[model samples]
Target chain A: MRITERQFVELIRKRAPSAGGGATVAGLRHGLRQGIGDDCAVLAHTRQRDLLVTTDLFLEGIHFRREWQEPASLGHKALARGQSDIAAMGGIPRYAFLSLGLPRRTGQRWINEFLAGFLRLAAASKVVLAGGDTGSSASGFLADVVILGDVPRNQAILRSGARPGDEIWVTGTLGTAALGLAVLQTGGKLRRSHAAFQAFCYPEPRLRMGRYLRQRKLASAMIDLSDGLSIDLARLCEASGVGARIVEASLPRLAQTPLRHALHGGEDLELLFTVPPERSPELPRRLGGVPFTRIGRITLERKLWLIRDSSKIPLPILGFQHF
Target chain B: MRITERQFVELIRKRAPSAGGGATVAGLRHGLRQGIGDDCAVLAHTRQRDLLVTTDLFLEGIHFRREWQEPASLGHKALARGQSDIAAMGGIPRYAFLSLGLPRRTGQRWINEFLAGFLRLAAASKVVLAGGDTGSSASGFLADVVILGDVPRNQAILRSGARPGDEIWVTGTLGTAALGLAVLQTGGKLRRSHAAFQAFCYPEPRLRMGRYLRQRKLASAMIDLSDGLSIDLARLCEASGVGARIVEASLPRLAQTPLRHALHGGEDLELLFTVPPERSPELPRRLGGVPFTRIGRITLERKLWLIRDSSKIPLPILGFQHF
Candidate 1:
């Protein structure tokens, strides 16, 4: 017979009489007006600042295999995904709420390591770990990271500003992360110190570049290369009511890498942005050591085309998809 | 052989070309500075208002069994849990970020109904569904709701301010929701139209009462009864370094209900607060047609006891536990 509700309540209360409140909670940090043990957390924000909010979902099998990645890195990647969204908006992330669902039998040590990894990024970003929910999942793990950020009032850069004749640019070399993933997928025991392994395990977000571009009003429309060049560019085009013509030769890639990988690899976390023709000269060759390549230009026609040597053709837009 | 990433990307982009951007995104409403299709949602706020944020977790096989609840009610309950946190703090909820990890084969219709239910609460609360993350899960469903609200500068109530000798009060009758849950748990057929079912399925949050108490400076410390009186009040006392004493007969319970259910049932969503003895007379008997009863008084000692039939005894502090 199933235990009655009263009996269950009695067992739970007898086992843990302290309730959920405690003097300290993991993931608490400075700048949190209200910490754990409260109904809601209180945070302070300036009036003229535009708050940036973003959330990202990660599932056990869909996002990670758990066999190849450590708990710390998984935690890092989860927070990084949400933080990258803030970076793409040219906003400074300040607070984070992490909700997680843990499957039965996961060790408390696993959680400690995950929190350690998550808090590392939070501390680096100067973000306060404020509030979130976490409970047990019967089958597998799931996590959602919500980031709260802010920019100067009305200073947010959107994806709706690119027009015809704007110059398209990309930061960092393409296809490295894809190469890293390929290495990992083949059961290649690569040294974690290898560049490809690092790229796959830890994709650096371009937050500083986004801020510089937004503050200087350099980019007309901007989007991160989260879904690869072909697909994400289509979204940027769709948003701006314009088209794109990128030269295959202009894309910066690792030596001898396939052009397809450079064009189709996702998770690069680089910035793909457009600058008007007049301000194109103001663009620097390099921003903080990362290479900036002028890969294409916006066009009057609202479609994506690739200009190969001597001939131009339509390119199929594609990327990593969750559903 | 594993499907090539290129082929997978093509399939995904072809299937969902919009990349989840569309006319109808769930949990979306006004007060959204930037909606779907943006890198991050930008929101407007003021310095005079401190931001209130809360997140709640719901897991399959833990919070609710799918066999017992519909997708719509599950969605409603998920969002309501976070909204109640805002009400408990005497703040107005403004924005929401919902993250869901859906299991395989859950179907699009399940998603549609879930959003329908979630949006209903958003519309009623005047809360905007700003941004969130959603993805496919490998196993069971998990949902996390993050609510953003604001309270006037520092007027928001905390659980750590109740002093000794304060009159404790509670709003609404206790044990109704628990009765409804018990009915459902015992395999009894409960129509949605029944009062018991309504009490369980559609628990109304006491936002107006919390606000009135805050505006009038009437409550010293306030809490919501999500985890029953015994457990939740323990949290309040622990937070404030005080204790509480209550006459068993003073509690407002449904007629013919056992006192045990009134003390241990979770998810009632009623407000329990303390008012200073000097200003207890200023408290209203009814606010927004909800009944209020002076349940007992806070005491100088840090323990909980029930006075009954000329004798006092220790009350077992039992309610709900997630782990």
Candidate 2:
């Protein structure tokens, strides 16, 4: 049987060498705090800071189609995916390494444009392009971007920190990117100014909001909504050993997007987090021009539930999976 | 026209944002020390150590063929390429991040064997597989391995450190991996015990030897022989703004391998370094069971020369290049 992405990750995690606690070298302590299951692997870096590392693969056909994506948007999205991981963990992105494989038919202008889009985002995020490898591809173009970020020691948010009474919250609207994907797939001619198009092609990572929540100790647990709300919420619940109950009417979504899209579509790139009931009062109604909407609450049960009107039903664990 | 790998790297370097000096965040300083042209990007990690980061792409058709390579060796070689880069800079590899894209036909047993080989090497070198990303590939299997290593502060031996009158040195015999590749290409049946076959499948990174040379401060400059003697030497010369002259008779190679393979074939994973004339007497003939051979000397003129039968001729920079 073909191995799913989740299975592959689990296999590696089980086989990986355990860096128990931290290794002491030259009287310095550097150990891994989080590994395979988190948005980013957290490692002890300096005396007061922890390093955050995340790797993402953007492949042609699997992740995007070249005919539909502008080279600039492709580059921007590529870096954004990794940056979002840092944002999810409440860290500051510092360095980025990009490994690119280009087919023989690729031209210089395309590469230049791709770099332009990538560097533009890097400058905005203050991430330096440190080093990477390039090779000739026999198939389609592929890019793997590795991002390194820094967070305050012992304060970086994690997916497993949620408690039972925490309220589930999301930043910005979900399903817009998925709606944009639908538009693209249907060969619809939409301008860059279109909301769905913009969301799908140039999703912005909520770095400032993530840092704000982290600094104030507002979020007990957090994860990025890259793979839609339903599945991502399931992941957070799984890690925290809690279930979640979502109010169908309370989810923030675009008017044009279907409820199913908001619940199951992937690549939204928003932040999904939980705040303790007592600390939820400290959260602002809006932070950095993005609205925070509470749509659910963490439960003691070990299964996901969706509340529509007065009835509660099971929420399917279907986001995006490559089997 | 297609951009060569050198041109692509130069382009990125020219356009990449400079991390001037080191940035201070929360009273700690971290910054990029070297980037792009080196084997690994050197970053100032802590007060006592520097961080070395390198990324490499191993594509199915470009770097290996699935039919010819065992899955386990593919995994080992993928990690070896990045580890070799760390060794080239005289650093100790700490963590590795792998981004693997597998085709639909990839079997679970193949993956298990691959991980087995990978973890075996990691256990040997004390390298930890901290994190990685996995995805489904629409084409061939591609793996991108990122290795992070540590070196003493300001102690990384870079290619640009070579000076005129420095004696050129190399560790181990060259071109064995290339010879192995030739055997594999010809469909020749060779046992794993065969030196050439072993070299092709399981080339070891010279970590201990590199640390020895770096700690002793014997080498003026260093680079790993990844892309053959002539081209990698040319790269070192270009980086140092110096020249090199090689004595054809002094090259250490297997008697069965062709002179052309010894000179221009790649993937030896050997250390090619330069030492000052005064320090030459302190160098050992052998360390860690690997032989050290003097093959040439750095030149005042900015060109490469090969001396044969007391007659000197220009050495062509015709090592492997993908465009």
Which predicted model would earn the best DockQ? 2
Pairs of residues at least 3 apart in sequence or in different chains that clash in candidate 2: none
**What is the i-RMS of every prediction?**
15.5, 2.0
Docking quality band of candidate 1, CAPRI definitions: incorrect
TM-score of 2: 0.98
DockQ of predictions, in order shown: 0.19, 0.67
Worst 10 residues of 1 chain B by lDDT: B20-29
- Tens digits of per-residue lDDT, candidate 2, B111-153, equal 8988888888987898889899988899999999988888988
Give each model a TM-score.
0.84, 0.98
Tens-digit per-residue lDDT, A75-152, candidate 2 = 999999999999999998989999999999898899998999899998898888998989999899999999988898
Per-residue alpha-carbon lDDT of candidate 1 for residues A1-323, written as tens digits (9 for 90 to 100): 22322232233223221222222121111223322111122222342445567777778888777777778887788888777777776777766667677766777678667767777877777665554566667777777888777666555677778999999999888887788778778777778886566666777678788888888889998888876889888878887889999999999988845777789988788888899989978888888788789999999999899999979999787676665
Q: Fraction of true contacts kept, per model?
A: 0.42, 0.70
